[model samples]
Target: MIDSGSTATRRISRTSLVVALALCLALAGCGDSVAPPSLPIGSHRAATHVVAPGETIYHIATEYGVSVGRLMAANGISDPRDLRVGQVLTIPGGDRGASIGTASSGVRRYTGARSSRQFQWPVQNGVVSSGFGIRNGAMHDGVDIAAPAGTPVYAADSGVVIFSGTLHGYGNTVIIRHDDDYATVYGHNERNLVSEGTRVARGQEISEIGRSGRTTGANLHFEVRRDNVAENPLAYLPDPASSDRISFAAAGGS
Candidate 1:
């Protein structure tokens, strides 16, 4: 888990990739006060869900805030390939689905599921304004992608939108809980296009660029958290493109 005393240091990285971070009170910095709307990830009991076309165990488990292993165990699903559209499976936990928010206090445990899917750039065009590490007197847990205000922000991978609302200092934010304890944060958004509990495809438009909270300018505060611990987003993002790709510039430089 991310401690309040996490260290900070400036670091620049290579270019031509698409990893991410955020400047929200939930992950990085905290200031200001915005009353966010209540998330609608209503209770999810030990219910049964019928499979839909193009659905997989990953997306299904994410939607119910449960892990694929748990779901498979509950329903005795041996091979994931055995699942077919119109098939029914039992959800493990009985009628209690908390909105998947930051891996903060009172967070639920979700283990045993991993995504093999690849990640892509969330923004069409941007510059690496900041890299992850210690910054000022606090830990800059995520990177900042500099872009024009209103630039479309897409999902890094397919997963469930566990939290989509404003938080103190984050102006507006959307947090998606991907497979295998992988969660991505898109903060300081001009607007959030998706809602909590909504499943999004890889590269799907989720928000827009904005200088909502404590930021130097219009940028997307992106973060990829592993089991609540801050990680270097650039490490997982694919190599940046030739011209209009997300460039790391260099490591230990941003």
Candidate 2:
């Protein structure tokens, strides 16, 4: 009887062990086959993307709504036409499908999403008599247009008047602060029509052309500044070859 009881106990123990082992194996299989939750579409982390067959920088830039220059700047690329298959590239800046703009360190950000309006001529048919740059060992910060003293000066774009008074070396200046870190300056104005802190729309009258700041001739000195930093206004302005249009006014007469 004692032997039979011991055998029965051993058999039950073995059965329980087998059942536990089977249960553990089943749980392990379930865990292994479980699928992870998917991330939402267009939820991309900022990383390098591999170039596939038939891919070009222009096509990618167009598809992504990013500028080619910006893309190249972000990826440290010198040539846009020289892309290798399976090569890695970093996207510079993107909207990321969010209303808020991306904020990268050392990068300027513009929150307003308004379309750029057509700029008007500051002085009608005025020739750029002077160009921007060093003139006679002096830094000329804007272009000069030789217009009549009474010639009406129009606002380049719709913006608020930040300053409408005399400034050092830019006498009788009128500065308009526009969106996207843009600021237009009209210097050597004979008269300022709008006061500081007033808003003026594009093509609106803002000042009169004159030689006010120790200048030699009646002219309008205009400048377009980005983030208060000066750039070649000729690059951003309209092409002169297509039409008789002066897109921007450089530091000196052009």
Candidate 3:
């Protein structure tokens, strides 16, 4: 009986040891089963959550770790709550998309530089009465040359004639698309001497001055454009007072 009691005690001790080992293993696994704390997504990082049904802009912004103001400003959205259901809004620098504000600001500044490269005399002996900028609330995009009617207007540079005809406000207009992504428009013309697609040399006779385009007197409405956007002609062209020549009529002439 004594030997049997001792054997039973040893068996109990071994079972307790086994139970303790199993409990320790279970506890170690339970600690791992607890999920880790979520990390905060940055504004520039890629989005992790998609907008679900009934998700508010504030909720989306908070979920993505960005401010509502940032979302609106970056996307040019005036109203934060008015986002369309299917509109994919960028999370600031998310998606690696280009910033609209930065790109347009750079474009405006670069365009100012391009306007300074070349110039032309709208009329041979004309004086500039009005320069580009603002008239009332309307932005004046070109320079106004006060010359007598029938003053010969020469092509400002070598270009292919893109438009030559009468416009509603410009009267007889001639638009020339030149090389180096430059173009010039001669408006308020009494006569158009060039036709569409005609390749004209610099200083070639292209039109004659006239009082058109709701003008007060006979003058040449001259414009210089780059990539179709009108730039200030006065910024790029040389001063009309300095050059004694009437026109660039012989610039590209053989």
**Segments of candidate 2 deviating more than 4 angstroms:** 1-119, 240-254
Q: What is the number of residue pairs that collide in model 2?
A: 15
Evaluate all candidate structures by whole-model CA lDDT and list the values in order: 0.58, 0.52, 0.53
Query: What TM-score does candidate 3 get on C-alpha atoms?
Result: 0.51
lDDT by residue for model 3 (59-106), tens: 554344343344555567655556767677777534322211111111
lDDT of 1 by residue, 1-254 (tens): 11122233101110001122222244324221110001211223577888999987655654564433445657877566678999988875523342222212111111212223346778878876565433332345566777889999999988877678875565688888777667788888999999976889999999999877666678887777654544445555655657766654222211
On TM-score, who's better, 1 or 2? Answer: 1
Per-residue error (Å), model 3, residue 233: 0.6
Query: Candidate 3: where are CA atoms >4 Å away?
Result: 1-116, 241-254
What are the TM-scores, per candidate, against the unseen true structure? Answer: 0.54, 0.49, 0.51
